[model samples]
Target: MADWLSPAEWDALRLSLRVSFWATLVSLPFGLLVAHALARWRFPGHGLLNGLVHLPLVLPPVVTGYLLLLTFGRRGWVGQWLDQWFGIVFAFRWTGAVLAAAIMAFPLMVRAIRLSVEAVDPRLEQAAGTLGASGPWVWATVTLPLILPGVIAGAVLAFAKAMGEFGATITFVSNIPGQTQTLPSAIYSFLQVPGGEAPAARLVVISVVVAMSALVASEWLARRAMRRVQGR
Candidate 1:
């Protein structure tokens, strides 16, 4: 199977995996935090924060990419400051692709975790607190364990989304081969050229396989988490 794919195609596949992994890894913690806040805390601007979290699901990917470019591009305000102070840049780089993928996938991850968090019994947490467990201990031992399944599911969802992300990625990074070109971008590139259908079709198959595997893994993880909670 590896022999059948051209080096360029292989690069795209590997790059996609790399980008998706980083996106999921970086976003998981933040996603859990946001989901926990939304599910457990009632604060000012809660609705606004929730809306912002899910905005990408409703907004066009192109628009999100454009906004990221404006905020994080080399000459953009934040981008300029970042470049001047920290020498970090997001425009047209694989790191930029990771950022785009993370943003696009964030809502799905948050939603999954949020639902799972909401399903957990608050009474269990309260009991733990009454037993002299501190806030952090109750959260770490009781709350976190119950919601592990959701977190795993959310991470998987985010990973799958990052793997398939195209519009925001392309818009922000311009699809530079071996740099910012991910699986979806590679597939788009392949389809744009004459006699490119074969490669495109192969990529499509690869995408499907990856997506299905992630879904299956997510289910398995979720079930395992549930079993652990039940056993405890």
Candidate 2:
């Protein structure tokens, strides 16, 4: 793979994988919580929450990035407080790229998981509760297993989305070479200069391969999840 992609290209690819992995991992717990809430609960502000969750999909990537920058940048309020108290910085850094990718991929993950959650029968959980299982235990042993396929599918989709993320990442962290440059950013960078089409094409191929692999993996996992659900 190193020989296949140039050093810079390899860097971008590596960074993209790293960012996507961390982003997906970090988003999982939150995704599950939000998905369950959206799927099973009906609060007073349910519509508002749903709209807010899907807001990023309708908004331009640049606008989302700008908002992230304004809210999470070094000089931003949250950023300053974090920096002062926790020493965690997110502006123009790799972590910021992860945040951007996570946020960009979140809605898709939530939607997939929400659909799965909706498919589950509430009676199973109620039965578990009647059997003296705590809510969390019931969720862990019952609800979670039933929706494993959707969770896997959602996670893989988020990974693919994170891999392709460009606009928000670039806007939030800028193209700072190995520090913050992702696969899409590298491809964009390649396209900006003369005699860069070949490299850009190569990166595009890489992107397609990675995305396809994620999809294939998702399908396989979904099937496996079904098998488990069936006790096969």
Model 2: lDDT of residue 182: 96
In model 1, pairs of residues that clash are none
**Residue 119 CA displacement from its true place in model 2, Å:** 0.8
Q: Give the per-residue lDDT digits (tens) of candidate 2, residues 1-232.
A: 3587789998999999999999999999999999999998989999898898898788999999999999999998999999999999999899999999999999999999999999999999999999999999999999999999999999999999999998899999999899999999999999999999999999999999999999999999999998999789
Predictions in order: lDDT: 0.95, 0.95
Write model 1 residue lDDT over 139-171, tens digit each, in one string: 899999989999999999899999999999999
Which consecutive 10 residues in model 1 have the weakest lDDT in total? 223-232
Q: Clashing residue pairs, candidate 2?
A: none
Supply candidate 1's per-residue lDDT for 167. Answer: 92
Worst 10 residues of 2 by lDDT: 1-10
Top of the candidates by lDDT: 1
